[model samples]
Target: MIRPATREEYPHLVDIWLRASRQAHPFIDEACWRARADDMALRRLPACEVQVLEAGRRVIGFYAMHDDHLEALFVDPEVQSFGHGSGLMAHAMTGHSSITLWVYSRNVRAVSFYRRLGFSIVDEREDPETGEPESLMAWSR
Candidate 1:
């Protein structure tokens, strides 16, 4: 089931984000994601609109948004390919003219996932955080 996450569930979202990011971008050092998990738990999750998918009270995936920008979408690496990602995308598309997100260009798993959901790259740039090439993608209603 999918629903707005409770304050207590935010930590689970962070775990999902960290695990999925590591799984999707194995080229990036695992330590990087581990380093970011604290910020995600303490700052980002509280500041964004977060939704989670649960299976009998266990959080398996989540997506975060700021206005029409998709800040993050992640599923537990152990439970991927079971429609959680697509379910999150469909939920995000409602009541918006468009949604935009940035993904590392080399993270082909993420890029392909977004493309399959109708997002197309509209711009390309180097991510200031990691100095890595990235793409800005958008999906218009």
Candidate 2:
């Protein structure tokens, strides 16, 4: 099931974000993700509209959106490659005619996934925080 995330699930969401980040963005230092955990829970996740995918009462994935932009999408490493990410993306797209997101260029898997979902790379630039090349992607009806 997918629903709006409750405050009580922030910790679990952060755990999924951290684990998935580590797996998806191996080029970035793990410490970077660890240091951002608190910010994710306290600031980022709360600042966005977050929806979680639950399985058997446990959160397995989530997506965060701010207006028409998709800020984050993550699935627990243990439960990845099982369509959770696609499910979250589909849910995120339900009420919007268009959506935008930024993704690290080196994360080829993610870029490909978004492309398969109809998001096209509209721009490319460096991520200020990590100095990594990133692509700006968008999808529209």
Q: Alpha carbon lDDT of residue 55, candidate 1?
A: 89
Clashing pairs in 2: none
TM-score of 2: 0.98
Alpha-carbon lDDT, every model:
0.87, 0.95
Q: How far is candidate 1 from the true structure (C-alpha RMSD, Å)?
A: 1.1
Candidate 2 overall lDDT versus native: 0.95
Tell me, by TM-score, which candidate is best. 2
Model 1 C-alpha lDDT per residue in residues 1-141, reported as the tens digit of each score = 888899888777787788788888877888888989988988888888998888887889888898989889898999898888898889888857899999999998789989998899999999776778999999997
Per residue, candidate 2 scores C-alpha lDDT tens digits across 28-135 of 999999999999999999999999999999889999999999999999999889899999999999978999999999999999999999999999999988899999
For all predicted structures, in order, the TM-scores are 0.94, 0.98
Please name the candidate that would achieve the greatest lDDT relative to the true structure. Answer: 2
